[model samples]
Target: MINITFKVTVGLLATFGCYILFQNKLIANNVFAGQTEEINQNNNEVSEQTNGESEIDVVNFNRPISPNPVHVPGWYFVPGFITQPMKEYNVHLKNDFQITAKVGLNNTASSGFGGNYFSWFVSSDGVNWDKVSQNKHSRDTIDTSVLTDSSDTEGVRYYQAYSEVQPQVFNKPIYSEIATVHFIKGDVNATEIKVNTSKDYLVSNPNFDQYISASAITQPKGATGRVIWSSSDTNLATVDPYTGKITANPNRKTGTVKINAEIINPRYMRNSNVFGYKELQVKKMLEIDGETNFQNTVLFRLNPDFDLSKSKIEWFQKLDNQVHKFTNISDQIISKEIKLQDNNSEIYAVITPLDIDDKPLPNNATESNHVKIQVKDMPPGANRNVHIRQSLSNISIYGNSENIGVHQLLKHKITFNDDSETYGYNDDNVDGNLRIPISINETNIKIESIPSGYVPDYRIENDGLHQDIIFENFPIKRHFGFDLIVSTRVDKIIDSSFDYNPVYKYRTLFNTDETVIGKPVHAEFSTNTIEINPKDINFGEHSKLEKDDVNREQDLDNEKFVDIRDKRIKYSPISLFVSSSGFQRKGAPVRNVPITLANYDENGIEISPKGNYFEVASSMNNSPLKSVFWNRKQGLKLKFNKLNFPDGDYHTTLYWTLEDSINSQTK
Candidate 1:
């Protein structure tokens, strides 16, 4: 009975197994046939579409796979096991003629499933498709250059990312929504490199378009190309490497320079070169008063034809066969008045052109014309007044109208009507009034005395220092002569050795809002020397160190003065600092020492016994500072700190620093 039962069970089991195998085989065949039919249908449509149109070369891509479907347990088919479809993707054409497809994967758990392969395909006609040959995997991106040859065609091409998985059960491949990219015919070669500039020359210093540009022939008619700009002479001009713009050098001379613009990749064209020059020319001629005699004035003017926006103008007076150059002359105005000197004099002008940076042009340049004038001595005269010894005449000339630090005194003496022929005059006149032309820098003149029965009239011309004093025509004159003194004051100190000594004599009118005398106000140490020598301190071996005063005064002649100090700070006092290198016993280090200053005053005065010593500066661990007023009389009294001393003749070096600055003064 048991044997019979076993044979029956085996037969039934074999029948059941055969039924399951047959069903799986039928399902697999159906899935394969469905895929084959779809592929064949697409190929037939592509063939029909290409009958009259251009044919695209398609590359076949295939991946090896087992023919039989793998078996999976029913538990493996979880609720979310289905592969999710891609949401979004795009195709791009790179500069290197490669096509890149970017795909966005679905953020689902099934994204990590096996056989999550994506097969990318492209088609000129929407019906025809060919798989891309590169990186056909489960990645989110695929790049191929196969379609680059067709990128020149004028039409739309379609692409699709077909997703498939090696599933245990037979199923159709999942297809994503189609994406498209449009390619229009393009002419990529650049044919010409044309260089263009707004202007050929640089006038003065302009911040406009002082550069050159370049364009080339492309598919789009007005497309720009990558160009490199260069200059033939860097000293004369320079060009920006990437901007293709040109600029004149700051110290460029009056000459021409060549500018070149070349295409970075000159496939179908050549480069371009242009000639540029500086817009420099003396448009107006120098004019001056031709002739003048003693007590007369000469006028010099420059026409506003030349561009002075970046140039400097200088006036010169040639007197007594010596050329004297005028300093601090107006750079904004074109006219000037000169006073006649007491000698044969000639007045002229010098114009210097500047580059964009306001630096002088390389070549030495000047523009001017000379005017002749005569200055005569006094003629023999008996009625002339010589009793009035030097009368004081005060006048405000160039410089701040406000109170300045100090004014320099300029004095001049003049004797008139001594001799008519001395000034190139042949006729001797009895009733002649002498006219005295004053210099731009001369503010006032003093007269010794007026002739009897003769009154003097002072006349000013054009709101300037130019003036004429008319004396009553000498009555019963026998070559009358008079003594005259001229003097002026300047805020800045004048040094006799300066090449432009006359510059300090005149005030600056360049900027009316900031008019200054010769130089601005400033203060500094009395001398550049930093070492200070103090009186030796003597103490008995048994006596402890005691503080003492070292009376010291800065030499006014070498102290803070105008034109010699920094002129940046307007209203501020200078700072005085004192430091020491400790005390040395017998020229060897003994102990740390400190000192102090007291009774500081601008005027050098000895402090009274009852007077308190000022704690202005001290040489303690810290270097103490003190304020030094500019207007106050400055003096110093040094004090030493009390300390036990090793009595082998202690010595120390002191450093005194007077700094003129806003920060130092505030500290």
Candidate 2:
């Protein structure tokens, strides 16, 4: 007689000491932190606690309900619990999943009848049945060929087996647990991972984009590729998990960061870890920024990526819409003095980017955005396409006044513009004072007049050394200056044998080369005969809005300029008179702007000589003669009242004369 024993499933709860034990099935022997629950499978109330998002169902059968209970007889049966292993993942049915029924054959059991062999049964629904395989070998464990079809692709499937023997009335089959297991198209796990970067290296700057991409090889027909990216040091750089794009911290000067990418589908292989990594060089991009400060300088700054000692910089200036090459300033130096022509123009910088090791980057050079340096309210004479041509004349005269600034011979005027109020006037603490150094190389000369708001300070004197009449608290604010009559007198009987001419030189805030700041240029004044050269003052194109003041470059083509040639004498000589008739349009009776000519050298005397004359300059001498000259820049500057005239070419005549000393005549 043949004998048969039973195979037990693992960890099955025994309701009446007859249920089976199953692995991966809910088990909470000792009360844990989670909420406790009772297992009741008959009512379909079963709970499985796990870390994964999904759980598989294990079928438990009632021993009393089944006519063919889960048992094999060796003429008798022993009650026990059976437990079987279960998987948490969606068990792939397309792959090999063997449903083997294990039964032990007793060598000699005299107790008689036993189950013959094992037969396998399958089910689409849990309640239905279909016998798909039979165990032909009488030997012990039998394998069932459980081939999955497309219909079994979703949900759990049921597989079970029962052993048969000669006269097998007591040998009944108990279904194997839930689909021995459900079907998946194929293995969906990622086998390997590959990552790629857009560029070989990275330039670390917040403004530029850093990019990387990844792909995973999932061999399953229906499986989609997945990618998970990470950065070794998130403080320095970070990579997106799905997109693999990177963003670096701007404050990080220079550093290396490792990028990692991996992908694995939990459905097929939870323990399979496939990944790839690439070491990227984070280099710094060179950058620059520029601004124009109140000190009239363009300051350039560089990013901290380069060694300033080795990385030099060059500056360029754009004037009149044309780019021009500028001086290449030394590295580590930032400030550049702005020129007069730099008003309303663009300035930019180009630097060759370098690494900390003093090596140039792959892209050597970079340029900063064009910094438009707009120097506002630039002096009328301090810009291109328009000018206020004026200069200080060399003073040559014979005088015997006691004080210096109070005399006519050494008199100088520093006139403020008509629009001086446009700029704010601050106190001495804010806007500093103006210092004028009067270096007289001769002797027996005294300062005659020190204008009220300004006085000489810090007078330094040494044997045969220079002198400075410093104006300590001149009280003039920024862009606020007035016609300062700087007058001084000379002794009547001191060194008349040599030439005598003292020039009051004060370098204005703007450059003296481009604009005549101190004196009218290119004129030789002779102390002999009298003459005058008045150039045709062609105030260039003017819009109606430009009613401020003198803002035009004169016509240089006119071979005419005004000259006052006065022969030096000790007082009481003659008086020079000036007058002008209002200009009228050529061949038309319509009048133009009324003339409000200001003669600054003569105490800032402004006259609107409609039809009369005004005495402008005089000395104590009864006889006066020759080679003293004046141009628009030297002694004559015109400032008109509010302009309310029509546009037209206008002409006017200016009259000047020197009164005769003996016959009371005028020249």
Candidate 3:
């Protein structure tokens, strides 16, 4: 949620009088007015009884609960009377109400307040306080007629008072009640029908995208009445009839507009101020946008609409406590050494508009929108993501799927912004088609699926030494599925850091004309080795051959051909070779009628027979994935007369050798 807080006005008592107040033992005053002599004599005893605050940590100590007002005779405003919880007032321009704190003297010899010090303080938000009024010789009244509030729109304010007597009489300082005041615009209860309206306003959004909010605070707080609004010049600005919001005319470059709001209540008497008009100055709104780089180093920029020579920019940073402003730490907008307490802090800019002559504009300045950022503080180009990973539910068809490690899948959610806006990794994204141009870089990866918009078609084609996936027409939406294929540098097991050899490569493109190198997409992989089944081959029996059979061929079923499961996730150049010994008839001596022996590769292609061995189907560099090597005809073959050799379930053992990693030589 993005929230904006405007300026607030404060009262003199709250801002100039609120300060440190020490809580000590309360001193009861002498009820008898004639005990002035005895009271003076007991001053030492009173001072000794109330000096316990010396041991207390005043700033951090728990504030004593606001005691219910004691109506006892001499406690006067010991709770220092500012205002009560039920008090309400109006400060139209400035009300003449005098806020005073009366301290009832303790039972001392003197009946009158002679020697004492008094201080008053005020606060808008309860947590922060400011001193507003102070005096010696026991003066305690605050004339609010000259005081203005922190905000012209907000009416609530808080006040507290501290008082102490001199000459060691009743050594304890007096504490005041936290006074709450709800102010209506003017003395509406005493006037005729008058609506709450400010005296001046600045309409900064020249495009009229922003509105001037009219505050509806009435005389009686939540008074049941409707307000009607009007503008003096339609070309300069217009007011919403029902909402009372004022919008500047976008067509008009510069001008002054007057806004009038009328309250229809007829109970109060009429006055000239009842129809007071609010003046608005039309100007361009200054805006600031912020973005983070690689989750570190926040970058901020002002919109180009701003005229730098005539306007000055000031930057402010607010944590939970609004303490630091960027301009205070450094004059330059960019400060690498600025401190950020956490990711929750927000930074914003206040632009003071100046005229052609370099003088400030009257009644108005624009405040830019604020942003929150997370700074990892890494230099640049560092990918701190633990792994390329995602979690998807259910299963579907495999366009190009494998049992890859779970962490290898990159489930991406990208948001496109206008070319003018800057964005960093993992920043908040809204719906747009062409923001930052991003390309889908797939390293043996695939586009599994997506939630919305377009996902680049991860098209694979061979390019030089490594394979690359080209992201064609890839303008991404919110969420898209990018998957991976098993392509390793070599047939070796890898874990932890998977920056080893990669058989395929991928990257992003910017509008076809520009390109920026993206962060490394790394993953962790488990070691998988080539495996083969140790099963025997069986050829069905064939009938005896006649003289004419010597010219005919024979068919043999090598039941259960060579089976291999290439568990290796990465590609390694390897091939399976084969050889066979002569066929041996059980009870008869070994004989040969020219037997043809064979072993198949994963694709069932017979290994090419060299003097004794054959080369089976090779690898996936040319094809895709073929893991086994063996054919159904991988058994002894004969084309001779029955007289040449007797066929009594003759069999031969075919020898197989595997060079699982032929390209690299070993294994």
Candidate 4:
């Protein structure tokens, strides 16, 4: 009873709540409520049926259109049929959608609308369509256009097929990016210029006019060229512009002249090349008054006759200040005389070529030739006075002989020849201070000069000046003489004093007594006699002994004295001999024999007879006596403890006087 009453508001609210619940369930289950499974199945079957029918319908439609109809999009066009031959047709999809088109007549259909060939076209907007044909058309048959469709759900863009008969349809407008380039310029200016001479130039006469040719100017890039030449301040040199030649004046003085080369180039400015200056040495032929006689007056002349047109002569004198001053003389070919102030002085002349400015030309100027003079003196007198003197020519007797016994005296005197009446008295001065004593028997003294080759006019006198020159007791014999070759004139005078006889004395006495019997006795004696003469003596008068005359004599004397002493003997042997005879008698008949004899016997001994037997006789005889004498004397005895004697001859004379007194008286 309580549930039967209901409100309209509550009912509505309940209905709304149920609707919200059902929407939520539907959202959660992800399902659709309006369409059932059966309905979906039925719809799918219908779709299959419709597809089958559509496919069939399409097949039928394609068959009726042409036997090989190419299906394209839903809207396609075919060209009108003509008598042209049929060409093949190809269809391609656009945006993955199938599209086909054909224009060929089919025998089965017997009704084709267009020509035999067909082309396809595609466009996403459907306005600008591109043909897609298989023919030789510009457009490609394969789809290349990008298609967009409103019904396509996928966000994919792709190319559609397009073909055209003309190649212009594929080419389109194209633009390249913009770019820029730059460049710079380099320098091309010229720098230097050079110039030179062409050939050798002669500066002499007769082609002395030869000129030095100028060479062409060589300039660097971008420059104009010109040349100008100027010589040194003196106008001796000049150059011609047209011929490019440098010429020298023949009359120009000899010296170095500078030549300037001016280069006229616009780019190089006023540049100049200064060539080495040419040297012009002057030359000329000139002669002085012969070189043989450099003294006295001198003359100067020009060779080849010194023509006035060729050369001129100039005179110059050198002063103490070393300056050459000009003289007042004008001559070229003519000879001019010059006087020298002093005999030992020198004079000179200068020659110059006759040309403009009196300049010295090449091979023309001659240096001044010098000359010197000499002087002589006076003569001597005719008659002259002279005197002669005696000097030791030599003392050679002792020089050659060493034995004192052979030493001889030698003397030499020198004389002079006297000229003119101024002669004085000649005297013999002994020059005793210079004299030498000798031990010789004889000596020849002479007065002579030293040497020959002198003029002779006077004589020499050999007075007592060369006195008794003697040499004694010399051991060896030698010859001695003086050199009479007078060094000057001498007067010949001879004088001499000599002792040629060397005397020796000797004496001896003998006493003898003898005993014993008769036997014939004999005594023998011998003696030594030394004979020395003037010929054995030498006085050392030879030239070789003149150096030591005094010493020569002394030495010889000492040697001779030693030899004499050695020859003297003392108590030499005196031979004595005695003889005796003895006899005995037999005693008769036993009778006693008595014999008596004297005890001492002086001379001959006697025998006496007595008694009965014949007396025995005995006699004693005295020996003869002999004494040895040296020369004429008994044995000479010289006693000396010690003596030093040289080897030489000692000349000594000995006389032996023998006295023998022996008497015998027998009774």
Put down candidate 1 lDDT per residue, 584-648, tens digits, no spaces. Answer: 66766555655444444446564442222122322222222222332233444455675543445
User: Which is superior by TM-score, 1 or 4?
Assistant: 1
Q: What is the lDDT of residue 34 in candidate 3?
A: 7
Model 2 regions more than 4 Å off? 1-409, 413-453, 460-468, 477-487, 491-516, 520-667
Instruction: Show the lowest summed lDDT stretch of 10 residues, model 3.
Output: 7-16
Name the candidate that leads on lDDT: 2
Count of backbone clashes for each model? 22, 69, 41, 107
lDDT of 3 by residue, 29-119 (tens): 2100000000011111221111111221122111232322211111112222222111122233233333334443332322354555566
lDDT of each: 0.34, 0.40, 0.38, 0.25
lDDT of 1: 0.34
TM-score of each: 0.20, 0.21, 0.22, 0.15
Q: Which ranges of candidate 1 are over 4 A from the true structure?
A: 1-226, 231-240, 247-253, 258-450, 453-480, 484-667
* Poorest stretch of ten by lDDT in candidate 2: 5-14
Q: Best-fitting candidate, measured by TM-score?
A: 3
- Misplaced by over 4 Å in model 3 are 1-515, 518-655, 658-667
